[model samples]
Target: MPPKLPPHTADALFFCPSCSTWRRSFTNTNTTNLLRRAHQRRRPASTLAASSHPSPASPTVNGARNVPERFRELYAALQGVRDVAANHVNMSRLQLALRGLEGEKGIVRVAVLGLDNTATTARLVRLLLADPLSEKAEWEDYLQTYRMESSRGLLIRYGEQTNLAVGNSLVPTISIPSRALKTGNLEILVSSLGARSISADQTIASDALLVPTIAIQSTSTGAHSFVRYPVHKSMVCGKGVNGLLAYTGLVGRVNPNTADSIRAAFELNVGEGATPEGNDGISFVDIERAETALDMFRESVQNATEYEKGWTGSGVQPLVDWISSPAKDVAIDPAIKRLVDSTLDGAEKSIVSEEKRKVLALEANTVPEEVRMALHETVSAWAERAHTELRDSLDQGFASKPWRTLAWWKLFWHVDDVGMITSRILRRKWLPEAEKEVVWMGGKIHQAGLLNQETNSTNPIQNSTEFEISEEKSSTFSRNLWPTQIPDTRKQLTTSSVPSLHRFAQNLVMFSLSTTSLSSALSALVYVSTSTTSVYEAGTIATIGLFYSLRRQQKQWDAARGFWEREVREEGRQALKETENVLRSVIHEGGRGIETAPETEARQQIDRARQALSNVK
Candidate 1:
C-alpha cells in the first residue's frame, strides 16, 4: 500500500518482556567484546585455538553478539574458588590449638557431675550424640577406645562403690564425685608421684588419653585443649528431661529466630523489584528489534495518507466511514481497506464485555437531585492510591528471594549427654521423617533407667519383681493368679526365658513378610502363629522332660528343680530366699504335697508342678 515499505526498516521498540525496561547500551561493541573475552579463557587451549569465528558476511543486525568459547567453564571455575574462600573465613581458633594438646594432654577423665545413675548417664550421653551434624561419632569412638585403657590407673569412687573395675564402670566409677573439687590433695598425690597437674574441680586430669579414631586436628580441638563437638541446645531442654537438659535446649533456637527476622526484613526491602529481570534492563538486541518494527509500521501509514489517491465506484460508504469522509482524507488500497476493516471488527468482537472501557456522564437536560447525589458519593468513596500501594506490597511478598546464611551449632558442657550439633542438622534438615526413630530410641533409654532405678531401691517387692525369684505360690505369681488358683512357678520361669526366642522369631517374621497389597502384617502374623506352634510344642517337650525318664511325674519335679537352679544363678540369694518364703507361706495356707500312692502320687505331683510353674522367677 505504501510502496511496500523499506525491507531493512522494522519495529524497534527496545522493550523487554521480563523486566519491562528499555535496554540500549548493552548492544554496544565494547560490552560485547568484554563478555566474549571472559568466556574464552575457560576453554582448553586446544579447543580455544581450534574454534571457528563467525563469517563477516553474516552480520548481527541489532545489539546481539555471538557468545565466546568456554564462558560456562570459566564461570564454574570461579564458583569453586569462591567456595574455597568461604571455607577459609569460617576456620576457628580451636583448629590452630589442637596440635599442642594431642597424645597425653588431651586424655582427661570426664566426670559427669549430676549423672548419679548409670541409666540416666547412658541416656544423656546417647541423646547428646543423637544429632547428625555433631561430632558425635568422633566422641563416641573416643570413649569406646579409651574404655579399655582407663581401668588400670583409675580408682572410681562414687555412690557407695569405691575402686570399681573399669569394665563394670558406672557414671561415678571413674573418679570420686567430691575429690575433684578438693584438687590440692589429689594434685599433690599425683604431683608427688611426678604426674602432670591436670585435675580441676569436677574434672580429673589424666595422662591416660581418650583418643577418637577419626580426630582431625581442626575439628576436634578446643581452647581447653579438649576435644570439642557441635551440639544443639534445644535437645537438652526438650520434653521429659530436666536440669542440664533444659539449659542445653537453647542452642538451636538462636539461629531460628534470627533467620525469621532476616526473612521478614528482606520481604519489606525487596518486595516487587526482587527478580534480576524485573530490576535490571533487558538485552540490547531485543529492545532495538521491537522499537524498529513499531516505527516502520507507523511511517508506512503516514506515507500512504499523503501520497495515495483512489476512487471506488461501489456504494459502500456507510460500511467505510473513514473512506467516505474527505475531512479525514486518507487513501488505502481496496484490498488493504478490506483487510483493516475485517481485522478491527474481529478484534472488537473478541474483546470481553468486562474489558470494555466505560465513562460516567450526566444525562443531558436531566437535573435530577438523586442522580447528582449518587455521582458525588461514588467519587468520594474510591481509594485510588491506597489500592495501588496494597497491590504492590502483595506482589513483592510472593516474589521472595532465596536466603543465604551461615550455619551455627551450639555447644554444651556435657558433651556425652548433649552429643554434637551435626546430629541436630540431620534430624531437622536431612531426615525429618526419622524424628520418631530418635524419640523412640530415647524412650528405650528412659525405660532402661526406670528398670535400673527400681533395682537400686530398698523396697523388697519392687526389687524381687524387677529382678526374678523362683518358688511355687510366690507373691509375684499371686498378682496374676486367682485367689483359689494354685501357682506354677516353674512354668512362669520357663515362659520368661522364652521371651528372647519369641523376640527373635518376631523380628524374623516381620522382616520376611513382603509389604505388597496382597501380603499384610496381619496375614504374616497368622502365618507365624501357624508355623511357630510346632516350635513351642518342641520347647515344652524338651524343657519339661529332657534327661528325666519319660515318666510325667519325674518330668514335672525335674522342671521345677531346673527352674529353681536357674533363678538362684541369675538372681542370687535374696531372690531365692523370697521364693522360699512364698513357697512355705503357701504350704502353711493348705497347699498339698505329692502322695506315695501311684495314681494319687502322680496327680499330687502334677498339682505341685503346676504350682511351681506359676511361681517362677
Candidate 2:
C-alpha cells in the first residue's frame, strides 16, 4: 500500500489481488463447455436424446416386472410336458381327435334288434332312411345323392338277406373305398344285427345297438300284444336303455290279459317304470306319423345333444348321437385325459431312459478287465514257452555230435536249428493257440453285435499261413494286431537271423582253413630252409602247429556258435514279447470295437428323440 505510486496500478492492486486465480477458473469453465459441445457433436441426435431420457427397464429383463417369485416351478412343469409329447399312444389319440375335428370319414356301425319279423325290421330300416322333407319324386334323387356320398350313407347288414348269419365267425362288414384307408385316415361303416342274434351274451362290432323294434301284432280278440327282446350287455354303453320308442297306433287295441305280461317284459328288458303310463317312456305312431320322430333323431345326431333325464323317445336319437359324438368328447374324458397324459409322459421318459441305458451298455467295453488280464497272461505264457523251446533247441543244436557241428556245408542251404525251432514254435504252437483265443474273443464280440463285419469277414487269424505268404498280402489282408506284424516279425526273427548266422559260421570255417593252409606253407618253407632240422623234429613241430591251429579254430567256432545262439534266443524272446504286447492291444481295441456302430446309432436315436421332445414341448 505504501509502495503504490501510479493511480492505475493502485486501482489494479485494490480491485483484483487474485486476478490469476479468477482467470484460471474462467479458463477451466470455458474448456469444460468446449468438451461438452464436442461430445454432443460426436453423438447422433437420437443417441443424445436417448441418453438424456433413459429408457425404462424391460419386463423380462432380470424378471423386473410381472414375474412370479416361483417362476422356476413353471419351467419344471414344462420339462414333464416334453415327456408326455414323446408318447406315441398319446400322439395317436391327439391325431385321431384332430382328424375328427377335420370331419374325416370314420366307421359308425349300428345293430338293430327286438323285432321277430324280418319284414317289419326291413320296413323300419326304410322308414329310418326316408327323409321327411323329401317328396316322392325326389326319392330316387336323394337315394342317388346318399349313394354317391357313402360317408353319410348307411349299409344294412340284415340277417338272411345279406347272409349275415347269427353266431358267424366273420362279422359282416361293408368295404369302403381304398382311398379312405390312407395312412392316418378312416372311413364310415354303418351296419345292423338281426333280432334272432339278440341274446344276453350276443356280441357285435356295432358302435350302437337298436332294440325293441317296431312291429304290428295280430291277436284273435282284435287286440295287440308287444313282444320285448333282451338287449345284450356288451352293446349297451351305459346303464339302462338309451332311449325307447313305443308303437302308439295300436295303443287302444291292447289286450287287457297280456297287458301285465307286456309291461313285465318291458321292465325286465329295459328298466323298471319304462311304460307309456309312466313318465319315463316316449311313444310314437307307426308309418308316416314316425317321420317327425326320425327327423328329430337325425337332428340330435348332427347336433350331438345330450339326452334329457326321465325323457324317453325312439332309441334312434340317443344311439345315433352316441355313435356320431366326436372322439375327444366321448372317448377323452377330463379325468381320463389327465391320466393318459401323465401315463404318456411317464412312458416317453421311460423310453428315453431305456434307450439311453442301452446306449450306455453298448458303449461299455465288451471284454471284462479280468478276461483281458487273463488273455495277457496267456500270451505271456505262450511267449515264455516259445522262449524256453528256442533256448532248448539252440542248446541241443550246439551240444550235438561233432560231425553235425562241423557240417558247415549244410549252412549254405539248410536252416539253422534256432530258426527252425523259432518258426515251428511261432507258426504251429504260439500262433495257432493265440489265434484261437483271439478268434474266440472276436466271436464273443460278434455275438454282442459289436464286431465290424468287414474285419470279421476278412480276419487273417483263421488262415495262419496267410500271414507268412507275402508281406504285401499280409498288410492288405491283416487288420488284427497279432497277424498284421507276424509276417515281418517272423521274417526278422527266423529268415533274416538264420541266414546271417549261417554266413558268420561259413566265414569262420573259411578263415580257419586259410590259417591252416598258411601255417602249413610256412612250416614247409622253414623245414626246407633249415640245414640242422631233423625229419622227426620237423614232423613234431608241424604236428604241434597243426594241433594249436585246430585248437584256436575250435575256440573261435565255439565262441561264434555261442554268440549266434545268444543272439537268436534274445531275438526270439524280444519277438515274443512284442507279439504278446500286440495281442494285448488287440484284445483291448477289439473289446471297445464290439457293437460300436450299434451303440453310436442308439445314442444318435436318443438325441433325435430328445430333440423332437424338446420341439414338441
Candidate 3:
C-alpha cells in the first residue's frame, strides 16, 4: 500500500472543489498534480530573510515592494496631474455646471442627489486613510477620492413635477410624464357652496421613494464621476404640513446591458488588473497577500504536463484507460485505487453522451486533435512515470523515500486545488460587479436620455368629466427602471360649483321661491280667471305686499351677505395660490445651500493634501 499522501496537500485538494471544476478557466487540463514535490535539502533561515525585503533601487510606494511595472507608470501619471486647486473648485463648479446644463441629453439636475451619497463618501474617505499601505503617501489619494464620488447634494424628487413647496415658498412646476411614472401636484380647491362658505378639498399623495444615480462626465472624454443617493420626500400635509417633510428612495438595480457598457468604460480609464476601485483603502500587506496567492496559482498551472492538458473528446477514454492501467503492475492500495477511480468516474459522468464531449472539444480548440485523441495514453503515462520514479528512488536503498511513490495522488490533489484558487483569483483580477455602480467615459447614454424626450402632457382643467384630455406619444425610457404604458389623454377633473343665474334681462330666469311672491302670483291668476279688473286690482295689492315682506327680512339678507363675502374671499385665496406657484418649494427655505463648505477652505485643503502627498515616501 502506498503510504498516505502529505496531509497538507491532500487536505488542500479536497478543500477546494473549484480546483477540479475550473468553471471559468481557459483550459480543462487535469495534469496540475503530476509533479513530485521538489526535494529540499536544508536551507539556512538567513537566506529566507534576505529574500523577504526588496532592494533600495526597486521602485515602491508606502513600502509596497517589487511594484509591478504598470503600477509605476500609473503612479507617475497620477502624480503628474496638477489638479489640487482645480479639484477643490470642482465640487462647487460641478454643481453649477450641472444646473446650467439643464435640458442637455442625459443631463440630470439633483438639487440634492440622494440621501446616502454624502454619508457613503465620508465613510469611503475614512477607509482610504485607514489603509496602512498608504500611510506615508500624500493626501492626493484622499482628496481625489473625496471629489470623485462624494455626493454632498441636497434632496430632490425623481421624475418631474410642477410644484415644489419650500417653507412659505411655492415653486411653480411643469409636468413630467412617462408610461408607468407620473408626477402630480397636490391639488387644493376652495369653495363656498351652501353651508360651506369657505371650504377646501385637498388631494395629496405620498411621494414614491426613488434612488437616484448620477454619472457626471469629467473633462476627459468618457471619464465620469458617479454618485448615488436615496431621495427624501418633503411635502406638507394635514398635521405634517407645517412640520419637516422627508421622502424615501431606493437604489435601483442596474440593467444587464447597462452594466456591461459601464464596465467597459471603467476598464478603459482605470487600467486592467488593478484592484477593484471600491477597495482603494486596503493595506499593502493585503495587496501582497493577493499578489502571493496569484504567483502560487500561476506556478501551479505552469507545472502541469502539456500532453495531459490537450485531451480532445476523442482522446479522453484512452487517457482514462492508460491512467487506470497502473493498477495492473503497481499494486495500488485499495483505498488509493478507489480514490483514483471515483475522481475519474466523476469526469466520465460529466460527459455522459458523445455530443457533450464534442462540445467541450470545440470549446478547447487550441488543443491539437492528436493530443485530444491521446488522452488515455497520457493518463497511463502519468501512472507509469509515478511508478518508475518511485521504484528507482527506492532502489537508491538509502532511507525510504515515499514521496515519489505518492506523486500521482499529490498530482490529483493539486489539480483540484488549482481550479478552486484560480476561479477566486481570476474573479478578483477581473472584477465586473463594480462597473454597474460607476459610469465611465463613452458609456452608453441611451437610457439616461429620458429627460430629453417629452412625456404625455396632462392639463388638469376644472369641470371636466373625463380623466384624460388627449394622448400624446412620448419618447421611450429604459424598461429596467420605468414601465411603458399606452398614453390615454381622456382623463379629466370634475369641479363642484354652485348653480347660478345670468344677470342679463333676456337671459335671466324670473323664477323665485319667496313664499309671499308665490302666494301673490297664484291669487292673481285665480282673480284673473273671473274678471280682468278684479285680477288687476288683486295683482297690484299682491305686488305691494311682496315688496313689504322683502323689506321686513332685511336682517336675513344681512346674514346671507356674510356667505357672499366668504365666496369672494375663497376666489382671492385661489388667486394668491396661483401667484405663489413660482415660489413654492418642497424643502424648507434654508435647505437650498448649494455648497456646504466655503470655497476657500476646500481649496486650502486640496493644496494641503497635494503638498502632503508630495512629501510621502
Candidate 4:
C-alpha cells in the first residue's frame, strides 16, 4: 500500500483520480502520481466511448448469442429487468444449452411454427434430441428459475414459475397429450388472411416477445424426428385475442429501467428527491401479490414430469404459428375416403349422411353407381363429425389454452408487488451514471461535478468533467436510470437492472436498523390515535417525537455508511490495481520525462569506467 498521508482538509473532497472515488483525503504523492497516470492512460475520445461506464466489455443485449435482434427488443421493452439477466431463450445458444441439458440419446421436441421448416427443423430437432442426461444450470438461470428457494416467501412468490426443471431432465416416454398436439392453438394476427399473408401488425411483431418465442414439449416417441405440420385455419386478432397478448405484454414489462418507469405506468405522483414517508417514494398499498390464476394449471404440469416443459417459457411463438396455418376446411380429405368408409361401415354408432354423401361422392363412371353410393355415405358421416369437433374448440383454442400454457406467464406472477421488493434492494443504493464523453450537456445533471468540491466559477459546472453517478439520497429507496437498459445492479452497472433483489435490499436495511428505535415510533403512532388518559396520551406523543428524531438520525447515518462502504468496495484498495495500470501507462507512453536520478547516476558510472580503463591502458 502507498503510505497513507493525512488529507490537507479534515474532509478533503477530491475524486480519487486513480480509483474513481470522492476521497476525504489523498496521499499527496499518490494523488499526483494517480492524476499523472490517469491523464496518460486516457484514450482518444473515439476509442474510449464507454470508458466512463464500468465493465464496458460485457455484451449489451445480454440474452443468448446469435438469436435474432427481436429478443433484444423484447428485453428492451421490459420494465425492471436489465440486460444482465435477459438471456434469449430460443436463440442458437439456447438450443446448444438444451442439447447439453438433454445429453445423449434424448428426444425432446420444441415447436416453432413457420420458422421450423424442411431443413432447419430436422437440424434443430437433432440438436436438442442428442442429449438428455447432461445437466446445465445456465439454461435454467437464463430461461427460468429451476431451483426452489427454501424460504417460503420466495417459494410462494415464484412457485408456479419456478417448479419446472426444464433444464435438467428429458424423458422421451413422457406422454404429450394428443389434443395438445392438434388443437387449442390460435394465430395472433387478424389480417392473416391465409398461410402466406405477411400483413400482421409490425409493432406487435417487434415488441411482443412471443413472435419468435419457442414452445418446448416432451414427447413419448422413441424416434427423434421433427414434424412440420401444415398451419390451421382459424386466424384471429382483436380484443378476443387480448388475453394472451395481455400476458405477453406483461412479460415485456417485467424488467424495468427504474422505479419511475413503474410509477409512471401507475400514475403515482411522488416528489423526485423528497424524503420518503408513509407510502411515499416507492411505497405500496399491498404487501403480497397472490396471482394464482394459473395455480391449477401449473400444479398439474409440475406433477406429471417433476420438471417443467420447455413450452412454458416462450411457447407463444409456436402456439401462434400452429394456429396461423390455413384451416383444413374439409375434415376428411376426399383422398382418404376409402379409409373412412371402411372403418365406419359396421359400427352401430355410425350413421351415414346420405344427402351430404352424394354431394361429396367422387364421380366414378367406371364403378357401378349403386356401389359408389354405399362408399360415399360412410365417408360423409365421418366428415360431418370431424367438422363439429373443429367448430366446438373455437373458444377453447383462443382462450383456455393460453391460460394453461404459453400465455399463462403474464398472469402467473404479479409484478406490481415486485416494486416493493425493488424498494428494498435499491434502498439508498448509488449507481454510476451513463458512460458518455465528458461533455457539457444541457439539462442533464452533471454527476461528476457534484463530487468535485473545489469548483471553479469559470467552469460554471458546464465545462465540469466528471463521471455520472445515480446517487440515491432518499430516506428510502428511489432513483431513475436510462429507461430500460439494465445491467447487474450489484456493482457499477451500465444497463442490466436486477429488480429481483428488491426484497433483499429491504431486508438488509431493516436488519441494520435498531429495533428499539422502530418499536418506539410504532407504539407512538398506534397509541396516539386513542388514549386511556391525558398523561398517557402526552407520554405517547413525547415518544413519537423522540423516535422520529432518532429515526431521522438513523437515516443520515445509513446514507453516510452506505457511501463509505461503496467507496471502499468500489474504489479503495480494489482501485489500486486499476491505478497501477494507469501508472504503467504513464511510464510507457510517449515522452515520460526521463528518470534523471537513475539516468544521471548511470552516466557518472560510465564516465568513471572510462577513466579506470585509461589507467589500465
Candidate 5:
C-alpha cells in the first residue's frame, strides 16, 4: 500500500518546463530528483545532437558502468505489481534506458529484427502455453499445425458476389449460390511460366487472394522456426556472384583514397593473368563488395538475436564470424546496391512532386498573391498519382501491420528522414541571419558585465566570530529556564529597558534638531551627564562614563554618524567598481572564484539581532 498523508496535507503540485504548466504530481521523491537533474542538464528525455543554438551547461555523458543496484532493487519491487502493471513498469524503464544510450555520441541507430529460430520458437511456444492472458486452457485442442511445404492456400472466402477491388480496378461480379457446398476451392491452373517467374504485380482472375485461410498456428511444441534470410535478393552484375566488387563500390564512394589502391591492385592482378603470379586474382570491386555484404549480414544477424531473444549477453565476435561467411572471388554481387537503388527509386517517385509542391507553397507564402496564383496549374496525371496514390497505398499498407510493436522504430526513422531534410532547408534559407542575431545578443551580454558582490569579499558574511553577541540572547533565554530560582523582577526590568533605550534615542535626536549649533548640543549633554552624580560612576569608571557621555552628547554622535554613513557609502561604490573589475578578469581568463555568503550572513545577523533586542532591558 502507498503512504497516506492527511487529506489537507496530501495536496500535490507539479509543473512541466516544456509547456510551463502547473498541475498535480503523483510522482514520488525519486521522480522529483530525476526531473531536477534533467532540468540541470537541459535536454529532452530522448535527446538528439546538441541544438545549434547555445545549450545550457550539461553534465558530460558518463562511461558505461555495471548494472546499478537501484535498478536491481526496482526489478525486485516490480514483482508486487499486477501482471499488466509489471509489464508497463518494465517497458517504461526499457525505453528510458534505451533513450539514454541513444543520446550518447558515436552510438549508431540500429533496428533489431529477430527471425524465429528453433530454440527461440520453442521458448515462444512454452510462453504461449503458460500465458495467463490466454482464454483457452486446453492447449492441444486450440493449437493447429501447418507444414510449410503444403500447397494449401492461406486464403479463405466469405459471402459471395461481393465486388473485389485492388489498385483502381473493379472486377466483374460472379454469382455463387448459397446451395453450392461449403467453402469452394479453386482447381489448380497450369501456366507456361512457373509461379516463381511471375511478377508480383500481375493480376490473377479470381478472389482467392482476398482471403488468407492457412496461417502458422500455435502448437504445444511451438510454431515452426522461420529461416533467417535477407529481404533483398542478390543481383550479380557479372557472370558470377562476387561480393568483393560490391564492397569496393561502396568503399570507393565513401573513401576514394583507399579505393584507388584497391583498384590498382585489381588491375595488377588482371595483367598477371596466368595463375595471377603474386596476386589474389580478385577484382577490387568484387573484394570490397563481398566484404560489405558480409559486414551487413553480420550486423543483421546480431540485431536479429538481440531483438528476438532479448539477449544482452556479451561476446558478439563469434556471432559476427558465423554470420559473415565471405566466399572468395565471385562475380559482381549487386545485392546491397540493388536494394539501396530500389528504395531510392521508390522514394524519388513518391517525393518529387510533393517536394515541388512544398517548395512552391513555401515560396508562395513569401511572394505576392498575384505572382503566386500565376504559377498555379494542374500537375501531370502521372505526377498526381505518383504524388498521391503511392503515398495513400504505402500509408494504408503500413497501417495494416502490427504498427504498435514497431512504433518507436518507425518514429525514429521518420525523424531521421523527414526532420533532417526539413532542418537542412530551414537552415539554408531562413536561420543563418537569425543565428547571427542570437550570437550578437550573447556577445553584448558578455560585454555589459555585472558582478555578483555576494560572490566576493575577504570577510565571511555570517561572521562566525559574532557568536558572542548571539550567545547573550541564548543566555537570557536560558536564565528563565529555571523560573523558580530567578526573580520575575529581572524579567520586568529587562523588558522595560528596551522601550526606554528607544525613547532615549528619540529624545536625543530631537535635542540635536532643536539646537542648530553642534557644540551647544554636545557640551550641554557631556557636562550634565558626567558632572551629575556617582550613579554614572563605577569600577570601570572611564568606560562607564564614556558610554553614558556618548549616549547624552547627541550633537557629536549625530555628526559622527553622518560622517561614517557617507564614508561607508563611498566605500561601497568603490567595492562595486573593484568587483566589476575582478569579474572582467575572471571572464577573460576563465579563473574560478568562491561565492560570498553575504545573504546567509545577513539572514543570520537579522535573526540574532531580533533575539537580542527581545531580551534587552
Candidate 6:
C-alpha cells in the first residue's frame, strides 16, 4: 500500500512492516470468501433449495425421516402382529371346542351296559339293529365283528373293532355315526337279560348310571314276576319314555296268555307312574309279535301290485305306532338340553381343573419325581438282589472241591468251574430275574397310568435277551470279562474266550510245576547212582529249584483265584449297573414324553386359551 504495488505483489509481501496487520486481515478475509465460493459451487441446486425451504418431513443427518409413509409402514407391522395374535387365540378356542365335541369328526359314543352273558347280549343287539333282508354271511360277519370274549370286550363302531378291556373290566362302547350326536346329544342303552336284576351286574351297570341312558329289560315269558328298582333321573329323563324299550321274547308260545303275562310284568316293573316326573313311562314291546308283524309287512311289500290293495293290518299296530311316533323331527326336550349342557360344562370345568392340576404338578415336579424315584428304587432293589445272588453263586463255586483242587493233572485238563458257574448264574438266574422284574415294572407303570398306548402295546423286556458288561480299565487280567453273545445254556462253555484263557494259564502253571518236580527226582536218582561231589551238588541245586517252583506255582494259583473272583464280581456289578441305567432311561423317556412346560409359561398359555374359549362360548 505504501508504493501502490500490484495486488499480487502486495499479498505476497505481507511481511512488510508498515500495513502488516491490515494485509493479514485482508488475506484472511479473502481466503474465507474463496472457500465459501468453492463450497457453494460444489453443492447441488436441490440441496440449496431444500436448505432454503426446510420441510419438517425432510430427512436430517442425525435423525430419521419424519414421513407419513414410514408411519404407515409401522402401523401396518403392528396390525399384522395383532392379527397373528388374534388368529392364535381363535385357533386355540377351536381346538378346545373340537376336543369337547370328542374329536374333529364328532364321533358319537353309545355305551351298552349290563347283561352277564355277552353272547346273549350280542344276539339281542343284533336283533335290535339287524336288517331282515340281510344274508347269512352278513349276519356271521356281524357276529364275528361284535363278538365279546371273556378276556377282552369288543367295541363295534361302523363295523370296526376296538378292544375295550383296560385291565379286567369291559367298557363296551358302541359308536353310531349320526349328525344329531354332533349337536351334543348322547344316548346310552342298559339291557338286562332273563330274570337277572340290573343291580346284580354292578361292574358295568353301576357305571352306566353316571351317564344319561334308557334301560331295556329283556325278560322271558316263563318268569313269574319282575323285579322293580329305583331308576336314576339322569337315565330316565335323558331321552324320556320315547327312548325306553322293553322286549319280552316268546319262550313257549305267542298266545293271548303270554301277552297278558308280559303286560302284567311290564306294569309291575316299569308302570306308567314309574318315571320321576309323571312323563309317559317306558314302552314295552313283544318281540315275537313285532317280528311276525314285520315279516308280514315285508312279504306284503314284496308282493305288492298297488299300495291301496297291498296294505295289511298287523296285530301289533299299537306297539308299532308307539315306536314310530317319536321319529318325526322335534325340538330337544328342555330337560334333556339342560342335562347335556350341564354335562358339557362339567366336562369343560373338569378339563380346566385337570390342566391346572397338571401345571402345579409340573412346577412341583411331582409326577416325574415320583415315577423316577419309584423306578430307581425298584432297579436298585433288583440290583441288590442280583448282587446277593452273584455273591452266593461265587461262594458256592469256591466251596466246590473241583474249583479248589490243586492236583496238577486235574488242573491241566479240567474246565474252569468258577467261570462256568458264573456264566450259568448270569444266564439262568440273573437274566430271568431281570426279565421278570422288567415285566413287573412295565405292568406297574401301565397300571399307574404312566404308559401310553404305544408303549403299553408290547412288553418292554421282550427284546432284552442279551446283557453286556463294560470292560474295566483297572482290571489286572489281560482278557475282558464281557459277554460277546447272548447267554445260551445250550452253547458250550468254551464259547467264552476269557474263561478259556484263564484255564490255559492255570494249566500252564501246573505243567511248569509238574515238569520241575519230575526233573528234580531224576537229578537225585542220577546223583545217588554216580556217587560224585559235583553230582550231589547238582541234585541239591535241583531240589532248591523244585522248592522255588512249588512256591511260584502256589503264588500263581492264589493270583489266578483272585483274578477270577475279581473278574466275576466286576462282570456282575457291570451288568447290574447297565440294567439300572437302561431302566432309568426308559423311565425318564416315558416321563419326558408326558412332561409339561414350565409352570408359569404353561399357566399363562392355558389361561389365555381358556379366556379365549370362554369369550367364544
Q: Which of the numbered candidates is closest to the native, going by highest lDDT?
A: 6
Per-candidate count of clashing residue pairs (backbone under 3 Å): 56, 5, 49, 38, 27, 0
Reference-based TM-score of each model? 0.12, 0.37, 0.17, 0.14, 0.18, 0.33
lDDT of 4 at 570: 48
Candidates sorted by lDDT, best first: 6, 2, 5, 4, 3, 1
Candidates 1 and 3: which is better by lDDT? 3
| Top candidate when judged by TM-score against the true structure | 2
Off by over 4 Å in 3: 1-29, 35-541, 548-562, 574-617
Q: Locate the minimum summed-lDDT window of 10 residues in model 5.
A: 184-193
lDDT tens digits by residue: candidate 4, 252-311: 442221111111001112322221222211221110011121222345544423222222
- lDDT-better candidate, 2 vs 6: 6
Write one digit per residue (lDDT tens) for candidate 5, span 238-304: 1122223432333333212112112111211121112121222222222222223233434565445
TM-score of model 3 relative to the true fold?
A: 0.17
Error of 5 at 138 (Å): 46
Query: In candidate 1, what are the lDDT values of residues 223-243, reduced to their tens digit?
Result: 111122210010111112332
Q: Residue-wise lDDT of candidate 3 within 1-617, one digit each (tens)?
A: 11333444333322111010111111334433222111011111111222244442332332333333323332222222213223312222222221111111111211211122232322222221222222222232332233223221221122233222211101111111111111111111100001111123321111111123333232224343333321111111111111111110011222221111111001011222332322211111122222233334344655223312221211222211211222233322222222222222222232243335555543343233343234324333433443443334323321223222212223323323322332232223211222121122002222222122332123232343322222221111222221111011001000111111011111111222254677687767768676656766777767776665544433333333244334423432332232122111110111111222233433344344334333323
Candidate 4 similarity to native, TM-score: 0.14
Pairs with backbone N, CA or C atoms under 3 Å apart (clashes), candidate 2: 106-187, 106-188, 107-189, 450-594, 450-595
For all predictions, the C-alpha RMSD in Å is 50.1, 29.4, 46.5, 46.7, 36.1, 34.1
Tell me the lDDT of candidate 2.
0.36
Q: For candidate 2, write residues 589-609 as lDDT tens digits.
A: 444422332333333443553
> In candidate 6, which residue pairs clash?
none
Q: Poorest 10 consecutive residues of model 3 by lDDT?
A: 486-495
Reference-based lDDT, residue 545, model 3: 60
Query: lDDT of each structure?
Result: 0.24, 0.36, 0.25, 0.25, 0.26, 0.37
Q: What is candidate 1's CA lDDT for residue 354?
A: 15
Runs off by more than 4 Å, candidate 6: 1-74, 82-377, 406-410, 413-435, 446-497, 500-507, 510-542, 594-617
Ranking by TM-score: 2, 6, 5, 3, 4, 1
